[model samples]
Target: MSRPLGIIIAVSLVFLVGILQGAMASTKTTVIAEKLAFPWSMAALPEGGFVVTLRGGQLIYVAPNGSKQPIELSLPDLYATAQAGLFEVLLAPDFASTRELVLSYACGSEAANNTCVVKGNLSAQAPYSVINTQNIFTALPKKAGAAHFGARMAWLADDTLLIALGDGFVHREQAQQLDNHLGKIVRIHRDGSTPDDNPYKHSQASQIFSYGHRNVQGLIYDEQRDAIWQHEHGPKGGDELNKIVAGGNYGWPIATYGIDYTGAKVSPFNQLPGVKAPLYTWTPSLAPAGLALYNGDLLVSHLVGRRLQRFRYSHDSWTLTDEYLSELGQRIRAVYTSPDNEVYVLTDSAEGQLIKVELP
Candidate 1:
């Protein structure tokens, strides 16, 4: 072949590869359900549907055909304030046979509210109302106001559950304290009992797994890596994603990359000797919410950023490889993968929607 002809062919191939890469990253989003009132979190059911939570204090069962029914729940302490309300719904690992599920929500009046988790059985009939409901856990030192209720749940392979709690906005310093549950992730058995092997099992705060977090809204147990990954909201500009370590301090206010809402520095130092650094941080705040690890990729749902981010991690480094569905122009609240690996996202809005994401 002529030298000039070879050069032209190589350039054309490069341009073709670039076009294919761009096409592969593009996504198609199908709206599964719309006009929802602030849908927060959801989990796919083994029986062909989803159990979803709404920030307005409702539990909904959505069928495969997109039909929706409100699941009747009985909880007198259920609180629905600003950022506090029904937060997450998760089906048990044995849900196929047990019909059991768990819910995370806010409890108590506006004067003193805190995050809470409850376990219950769903009725066998239509509507599938929650039955035999029991309060399994509640975050301590319930504070006033409704700004930050970091209430997300993930279950380990051993069936133990991990619950993330927020710093209560006004009590950010307590996240550094070990005596309380604020800004901490706690591990407990299915029955709400603390596991004996937990790092703080023998201490006063027996269930505490890790501490020093702001408002963590995303939690996932990555089966591939056998690690718990989480992300939390920062004050102004410092959203963070971390690989949660047992008994580790995450350094909320004392060592933050974010500034106060008033633009004051949150801390003079960004890292402390005892506290662990974030695996990844987002500047100007993504306000990251839901997280899912699928096909070796970390998918994050962003609220203020109004997009979905996909990250690939390798050799202790995380790379933001793609951003999807930004044109939807909606605040994404949560993301989950179906059994077949299809990704679904929930929008945070009065006219909220559940969207299925498809990639080329």
Candidate 2:
């Protein structure tokens, strides 16, 4: 049985307070390395190391030994308002041959802002030039202000791509509608075209894999269960971690566990029919933005409840057993596990940092 809502909130609050009392009491080793201006998403490289995106529209590479290098790319004019900027960075499925990378960011004229995806290959020469830049996707129903650019990309096993989008803040109703792309999880081919085997293959309006997502900040694939998981920020306290399913609707503005920023009720009930419940919900909002699963057993010691929270599966059936807190006070913006079982995380702040974790 699931825990009570009140208990979950109280326990989360107590955990936060306990961390405050013992701010310097370190359980796992944490190393705050070179800081980036506004690092957003993270992607592991083929040759060992990782690449991060900057909100200022730049790409920074982190070497194996903690050295920093910034790659030069042509940055478009971005609005850089609330929750918008260089949001997500993903490597092309054929990164080895293409050396291509893709990123989502907010861009538009002076009065309006729209999210767009750009794809390019990292140059083989000095400065690491981004060549053959192309705009693969752009938001519909464009409007002003930087908000709800739900743009995170993931590759499916069949080579089709999945993009998570937000329901442009002003159009909360659009989230439940099939005709619009806002507030939706879209499935498309790499060329930005809808696939034929999609849930609503015959209906253009139903390219949506799931709907009513407020602002999905995290998108990841679970190899173990063959399910896609997403987590996003809620209005005030109803942050959520979801197991995404095709053609399903996730209650957003209509049904929520959170309230308005002004303390008004967003919903009177927790579970509503037709709207799916989350696998895990974070009340009081962890502001969770990044997610990645730990796939190994060796380096599991140090990452317990710390940076890389693990959810282990039972033998007969998938039963959740362990839950620990990594006592890291900072908001986790992005998470990715390395090929060697090391964990990497980026904190959310102006002086945001990239930290690595391994078994002690």
Candidate 3:
């Protein structure tokens, strides 16, 4: 009887260990929520909630638990097509003191349309109206069609605004021309005036902070480096991670490590005399869409896979250090980090999802 009892106890202990191991692995990845449709961009709000933008021109407030409240906000008539629509939603740095929110979307009259940014007040009550809606900036050379609006916004510490514009597919060569605002990152005052101190404010066709970008979908200010960083999609295999600099040019159709969609070579070489090279280039394309620097301690230091890519900055160069795939299989559209170190990501799809990275 004693021998039989010992065997039973041992078998139970092994089974318990296996169950515990499996649970830990699963807990490492908990899906806080899912089933959102065409979610585009996200802005972190106070008290641990986020306001997300949908391609259909709606803003939904999501609590930390993933419960959502669609704020019935009014949007200007927008022409959303292939890759254009409502782009980014962000709170002005002075939101707590001013209650101001800035929105970037594609807008045009029946004849011509381009990407534009507006500033307005956000109310929590019914019928959230964007009072004092002011059109601050619009991309130059309004090209027809709703493709490559390149409408993303970031703020510099000095209270200046940076807006990224896509080279309206009307002409790819326009990317290299400073006279055209398409395919360039422009820096301006909060009121939409070019800054006198801008890198190219004095040159002809130079409201451009940086140039030669294809479609810069991801833009953010990396606080630790005191620099702005961006990631843009490549034609075929040369998706890139870039450390943006004022007055600098990032070679787009010119010095790509990618190929045209037709599977032909994109550029003959990888470097050009004046254009900047990417800090890191992905071959065969991860189809990267969002970028963030992880500030939390729970993430292990050396895993570069997908969803999120983290870099370590040395004195002269950056090395890829970490990456993690989100629960949603779709492309990551945007990434935001709050003051308390919570990382938020928006996935692209008809039914998009907002995910939070929590460390156990």
Candidate 4:
């Protein structure tokens, strides 16, 4: 009832070869806007510009002319501490007319906080702001501390929203539970309603798409193969890039290739029965933070690794086709490809930047 792996890989090859007559990429970078505040994620606009999010509760619009304008927003009790902040930004599928957009941010006090998603309409012109904001969805059972509130997001082919969540650091075992939203990918309608056809719609939490992820930050939906790809941070080693399958259990503390920061073993086993294995594992910890599809390949940006690595599918798995942009010497926070097939990168720093990548 399912297509074979060989078939899928063959089709993917065709797609790569068909794009721009199978052009090989060369990396060239240019900084379009700079001096950002802890930049986390960015989105390329349907119009002629871009929007970048700083973890410090700010959204700055980078115009085509490279001028930056702070978009006004009022996220109540927006937490900006300890591996948390306002996260990803995504334009609505019909953004040209509706002007609606979504946001994922850390909400509540450090004593009790959760990952939250909100929908808001944008002003058309100068002094651009998100107006009429409303909370669409919020992760339940708010936890203490500011670590591992996974808020990365991607859109499904059916136009549903997918939000990735973390295991609350000390609560790593919850990544295997079903009653709560911690350490899972959740699917909901744009209006924050759960999708009826979700794999676990009847038994598990209606919002959960998959479970067992640790601090997932990179999530993308690939239309070419009708697949969702994600990456997450590992403790001291074993950062992973994974292909998400519905109802799949990606073992975290129960099955890890990495150890605890204290030099203790997190798990006795790195592979287990009924647990999905990673397609690729970054030993020694790449600290991969962002993932994007470039022309038919993947562009993975790293924080600790401090570089961008490109991988192409070959010999039945992702193979490193190229690597570049380490010369800029900044922690690459995120990489995004525009609807028009343009590339962009966000550098993470006190004085962050929105960079345009020319790959032709």
> Which is the leading candidate under lDDT?
1
Top-TM-score structure, candidate number: 1
Q: RMSD in angstroms, all models?
A: 3.0, 7.0, 8.2, 7.2
Between candidates 1 and 2, the TM-score winner: 1
Clashing pairs in 1: none
Candidates ranked, most accurate by TM-score first:
1, 4, 3, 2
Worst 10 residues of 1 by lDDT: 17-26
Pairs clashing in candidate 3? 36-351, 36-352, 37-350, 38-350, 167-183
Model 3 lDDT per residue over 1-360, tens place: 699999999999999887555334321444455776778778776645677888878778777787877775666667676677788887899987777888899887535777888888877443344577788888777777777777878888988888888877656678888787878899888787888888877666556899888877778786666878787777777877787988888987788888888888778978899878887777877766665556621121111224555556776467654445533345777666677777666667787767666533
Clashing pairs in model 2, backbone N/Cα/C closer than 3 A: 166-183, 167-183, 305-324, 305-325, 305-326, 306-326
Count clashes in each candidate, considering only residues at least 3 apart in sequence or on different chains: 0, 6, 5, 0
Local accuracy of candidate 4 as per-residue lDDT tens digits, 145-258: 899998999988899999999999999988888888888999999999988888889865788999999999799998988889899998989898899989999998799888
Candidate 1 shows a clash count of 0
Ranking by lDDT: 1, 4, 3, 2
Which tens-of-lDDT digit does each residue in 1-360 have in candidate 1?
999999999999999888557534778888888888999998887767888888989888888878899989987898997898899888899987888999999999989889999999988767679999999998887789897888999999999999999999999999988888889999999999989899987777898999999999899998888888999998998899999989899999899999998988989988999999999999999899999977889999999999888888998667787788788889999999987798999999999998899855
Model 2 C-alpha lDDT per residue in residues 302-341, reported as the tens digit of each score: 1112333444444322323332235665555677676566
Give the local distance difference test score of model 4: 0.88
lDDT of 2 at 85: 80
